[model samples]
Target: MWKRLLGFDPATMKVRTEILAGITTFLTMSYILAVNPAILSLTGMDKGAVFTATAVSSIIATLIMALWAKLPFALAPGMGLNAFFAFTVCLGMGNSWEFALTAVLIEGILFILLTLSNLREAIVNAIPMSLKNAIGAGIGLFIAFIGLQNAGIITSNDSTLVSLGNITSSSPLLALIGIVIVSVLLIRKVKGALLIGILVTTLIGIPMGVTNYRGILDWPPSVAPTFFKFDFSGIFTPQMGLTVFTLLFLDMFDTIGTLVGVSTRAGMMKDGKIPNAKQAFMADAVGTTLGAMLGTSTVSTYVESSSGVAQGGRSGMTALTVAAGFIIALLFSPLFLSIPGAATCPVLVLVGLFMLSPIKDIDLDDYSESIPSFICIITIPMAYSISDGIVLGLISYVLINLLCGKRKKLTLPMYIMALLFTLKYIL
Candidate 1:
């Protein structure tokens, strides 16, 4: 049973390799179980409720990936979507968490329809191969930016866009230590190096005063579980529906991009058909809807799981392993809380670097691909938003294709997307 679940053939790799891949995937992506709750807490949601939602959603999504998609990947609440949940939906819109959840459900429905209609394929094909590389690299830069900010290694300056924090400070020092350790291990070709760096950083931080600083370790006596408490009163309302649409659209492309790139790397694609693409998208849509109902942000695929695939994880067992780890972490929230931001920063930054490796394969001679590729790579971290970067890239790609007398390549749907992104920026 284990062999079947792990996609292992007795005729192939040893059991040790499969087990190691599972463990590697779990450790690299485990930060989501805690990070999602931390980000959601900023939206004034109940901490315990958010934690519960994150765990449940991750488990459900991973199970879908394992059983339905049967892919060597894992799913969790996405980073950009969480920021939107906090900064845009909750704070900027001044809406209740219930209203935010309603938006998620609506968007999930749209995602399902888009997938079933096969529109996702057209959208994916419209993007030049170079832009896809840029999207991957841009997301990497975005993740790295988040890591730096969370670790207090980057800060806003009065006159400039941003400035570096003092490395002499405790958080920055610990983050630097973690980064150096992880980089060294990676250079040494060590498997599970990122996880090792995180664990070591956490252990070292105890004496260096990171755990006590956040007051997160000082837990209250007994927090009860908050499960199945979905509030859908504000759904379908005009304003909330629009917001949900934005979130859903953003998440759809992000998931699609990651799925395409990772699936290609995993050898899951043949003749441009990603096997189970429709089912995978449906699972993601359902995961997001369920996540909102459970009181968390949008749930999607984790790109970091590619690192595990690189380590020879060819089956769904790796995803199951990741899901099991999330369940374990949910039960021990206090232990996770004790891990400081510095400990996890290294893993994210390292993963970001890994994602950028595809840039070397892109053909820069094609103007249609080159211009959008440049925009996509630079604008992500520069604009501090993945959606914004993608929007700009897509719009530029269409315009460039038209200019190069390759207007024949421009589909009606592509033009519509270009117009929509233009309106998004204008509005």
Candidate 2:
């Protein structure tokens, strides 16, 4: 039964190893419990409710990956996509959270349809490799900038538009300390470094009066505030279409990238392909759809799952363990919700560094690819819009290649995407 259900061979049970690996994966990525609510709550969602949603969605998604895909990967509200959901879709675009939820729902449905057809692979292939790497790196910068702002490490300057804040101040000082702690922990190869950093920072902040002491352990908060709150009034607008596309784009690549990276490390790939690629994509697609209904951002497979894989977790038992961990986490709403923004700043900064690793794989010698990649990387944070960065990058790629007599490099899907992006501006 275990073998049929979770690929758990009794001969090689190693239940202890799988359990430990699961717990390790959960602790490493559990920082999202505090960080996701902090990011999504910026758009007026109830922070407590968002915390509940984050946990419940993670539990559901990870369980799906366990039972259906039978992979060790865990899923949760993704870091970069949550940033885009709050900063770009809601705050920057001046849309209500409801509208953003609608966009997410659309994106989720579209992802399901795309995963069902050959179109998803075509779209993924249409974008150049450099741009794909740039998208991840750009989001890294964007979220890191957000972390700086939240910690008051960066502040608005009327004259210069942005300037450094006083690092000697209480919160900023604490944030700096937190960054050092997280960096040291990561350097030491500590499991759950990010979560441990957040907790340590929060504890340290108590003496400085930066972190309010909130009691831990409470009944799970109600998800009523954000659940099923979609608004479709603007569904036909260009902005809606663009937002949905951006959400889909981010989730697709993020999920795929993490799967490939973790699978490679776990020796789970066969003949240059993931063993259950379609089922894995379906797990992510379903997670996003259900997560939207439960009131959260896009749910994607976490690269942190690689930690579990490294711990000898080669079956769905590890993912099931992660789901169990999240179920226990659901009771700690007070603690997670009380984690001040300053506590999470270091995690965001470190995660940004993690995302930027892909850029090293990008070919810098090719001006055509490098220029567009650079534009995308700079525009995401500078323009304060992930969607705009993607649109600009695609348009620039097509135009530069066509003008340079390198049109052969552009695919049909690439031209179609570029034309649609151009029309987005013109219409």
Candidate 3:
């Protein structure tokens, strides 16, 4: 029954391991349940409704990944994509939140068409092996940076852009202690070290006054305010086209990068191609469409799934576990949200280290390959954008190889991607 439902292979994967992996992933990503509604609510949506919608949408999308795609990845309304939906399309462009949701709906439907055409999968396979390794390493650094910032271990600077935070402060101190605890457990080869570390740190934070323990159980918020709330009056405008294109562009490469980077780190790539690539894209497309209909932003595969993969989540059971977590979260949000960012931040930092291990495989002697790879590695964290890093890297790869007369190394998709990326910047 487990095998049929979640692709559980008894010889290779254990039920306990997959369950622990899923819990670990859920702890790390549960912040999205709070963060997404907070960001989207800025456009005047009801916070509680958005919260319910977030969980429902995540549950549906992640369930698809579990049963159909059969990969240990989770989907949610994405971080940056939500910011774009709320700030750029709604606030900046003076469009209503309903208008933005309509744009997302269009983008999601188009994503389904593109996935059916295999365009998204083609883009994934087109990335050379060297860049693929670099992407894994880059995502590592990117997630690590995110952890540090979230825990206040890294702070903003006016002149220099970023600087170290006060390590002695409550949040940063708790995170540092959690890192040491996790590191020690990891060194001792403890099973479920990541999940244990997060829980322990969260408990420790309660004493330190860092974690605020809200009451555990409550009725879930209604989805009425945001459900099927899209407005299509502005759908045919040029601005709507731009908005949909931007949403598609952002979700596509972000999903592509997460799919490639996480699969690469998990050693799930076979013959330099992701398994079940079509189904995976379909899961993501369905997630985005559903999320839009439910009154959220674009949904994409989260990079945090790497934490689960790091914990030996090899099958769809891990994703099924995540879906189960979200179902619980709908009612027990206060319990899950009680886990402060500082507690889970350490796990992301450690997982980042795990993701970076692939860097050793990149051949430094081949500058043509290595240079673009290096660009991708540095740009992810530096630019604080995965899609931007990939765009710059691919554009550089095509241009440098062409300039060096190494045309044989480039694929037709490579040329087309470079041209499209260039046009993205130009237009």
Measured over all alpha carbons after superposition, the RMSD of each candidate to the real structure, in angstroms, is 3.5, 5.2, 0.7
Per-residue lDDT value at 87 in model 2: 96
Residue pairs in steric clash, candidate 2?
Answer: none
- In model 2, the Cα lDDT at residue 174 comes to 91
Per-residue C-alpha lDDT of model 2 across residues 1-427, encoded as one tens digit per residue? 8778887776875887787778767765777888898899999999888888889889988998888878898999988899889999899999999999899888888888988995655554566767777776776787678778888999999999999999999999999999999999989988656667877998899898888767788888899999999998999999998899778777775676566545655656565456667777878888888889989999988866765665578889999999998898898656645667787778767766766776786799998999998998898889776667777888999999999999889898999989977986797
Weakest 10 consecutive residues, lDDT, candidate 3? 1-10
Question: lDDT by residue for model 3 over 1-427, one digit each (tens)?
Answer: 8888778899899999999999999889999999999999999999999999899999999999999988999998999999999999989999999999999889999999999999999999999998999999999999999999999999999999999999999999999999999999999999999999999999999999999999899989998999999888887899999999999999999999999999999999999999998998999899999998999999999999999999999889999999999999998999999999899889999999999988888988989999999999999999889999899999999999999999999999999999989999998
The TM-score measured for candidate 2 stands at 0.73
TM-score each candidate: 0.86, 0.73, 0.99
Each model's lDDT comes to: 0.74, 0.81, 0.94
Tens digits of per-residue lDDT for model 1, 4-115: 5545566755555555665666766666766777887776677767777887888898888777776777888888898887888888988866667667767767777887
Which regions of candidate 2 are displaced past 4 Å? Answer: 1-51, 66-107, 186-196, 223-281, 295-322
Off by over 4 Å in 3: none
Query: Model 3 clash pairs?
Result: none
